[model samples]
Target: EGTVYRQIPDLIFEADYKDRWIELQEAADPWKCTLPGELQEQMKPFQRLLFLKQIKEEKLITMLINFIQESLGQVFTEPPLFNLNEAFQDSTCTTPLIFVLSAGADPM
Candidate 1:
């Protein structure tokens, strides 16, 4: 006979909690703006795919960071004096993937 293992139960939050949180979010950003239709129409198929890919990648990185912090009880820090040129030049070193979280608009 095979041994049976019990599955872990999922977390359950209060009823209406999700709805109330969503309402608060909508109230905070009532505009609920999105990419302009004109700009979206102008984007090529590849461009649209690339944009979606970038968003998915951002979400993935955030989840990974959160998981690491929760499991290890420590936040990961960016390495100091990270030289892109040197990293790329090394044959043994794997190229690191970089995601731009934010960038300030250039002054006119």
Candidate 2:
């Protein structure tokens, strides 16, 4: 329905708990496999897809928030966490629903 964070379960298996950039980047070519050539060259401006995906990863995200908070000082509280609905509204968005999991099965 919305922008799919991912389709392949393996890519998402531990993502909610741990960081996955180093792993996914290393999974293939690390440089080109996940991204296209232009984005690799542009450095600042990125492709929409990569931008969306980047907003979702935790490590990259925290770094972004830290950068903003560090620069903005007391005004900013935290960095943004990737919420399908929130990215548009919340600017200094950290402390998102993350690093968590649910267990056991419920009969469907």
Q: Best lDDT goes to which candidate?
A: 2
Lowest lDDT block of 10, candidate 2: 28-37
Residues 37-71, candidate 1: write the lDDT tens digits.
23234544344334433435544444444444544
Q: Name the candidate that leads on TM-score.
A: 1
lDDT of each: 0.39, 0.42
TM-score of each: 0.23, 0.21
Please list the residue runs of candidate 1 whose C-alpha ends up more than 4 Å from where it truly belongs after superposition: 1-15, 18-58, 75-77, 80-108
Residue 29 lDDT (model 1): 28
Query: lDDT of candidate 1?
Result: 0.39
